[model samples]
Target: MRPVVFPHWFHRIRFRCKVCHAELGFKMRAGANQIKMTDIIDGRFCGACHDGETAWSVENCDLCHSGKAGLPPGIFGGHETLGPGRW
Candidate 1:
């Protein structure tokens, strides 16, 4: 199964940064949070809103987990670094 390709830019257009970063308590740093399907199913993280009402339900596997397979993990489309100026 392909990993979920989280359309950050797409979500950014609909909601503000605080929606996920602040209110949801998501870390600003990429790959900072170790997300799990169980947590989301329990109404945490993405589940906070994606419970079929605010957003799509997690049952829709293909919806989110659509990333290409065999890709190196750790924030796709961006460079994985230690921190500011640590790259």
Candidate 2:
């Protein structure tokens, strides 16, 4: 299956770490969550906010899943880094 690109900047801009990690209960480490389409569809994991009404819907797969492993350097798209930038 394709991997999900968790947009840290996007999330952090609108929410706090505790919102997803504590209130929504997302795992900190990668590969820790047994994420499945069904789980997301059932309002679990990413589905908590991506339920269309809350945030974007999960069916809009292309927004998150690029199907490509880590993007190459120089492709940062105006950002200084892959995530946190120059901080």
Predicted model with the maximum TM-score? 1
Q: What is the C-alpha RMSD of each candidate to the true structure, in Å?
A: 5.2, 5.2
Show where candidate 1 strays beyond 4 Å: 72-87
Per residue, candidate 1 scores C-alpha lDDT tens digits across 21-71 of 999888987778888899899998889999999888988998887777975
lDDT (Cα) of model 2: 0.66
lDDT by candidate, in order shown = 0.75, 0.66
Q: What is the clash count of model 1? A: 3
Q: Which candidate has the highest lDDT of all? A: 1
TM-score of each: 0.77, 0.69
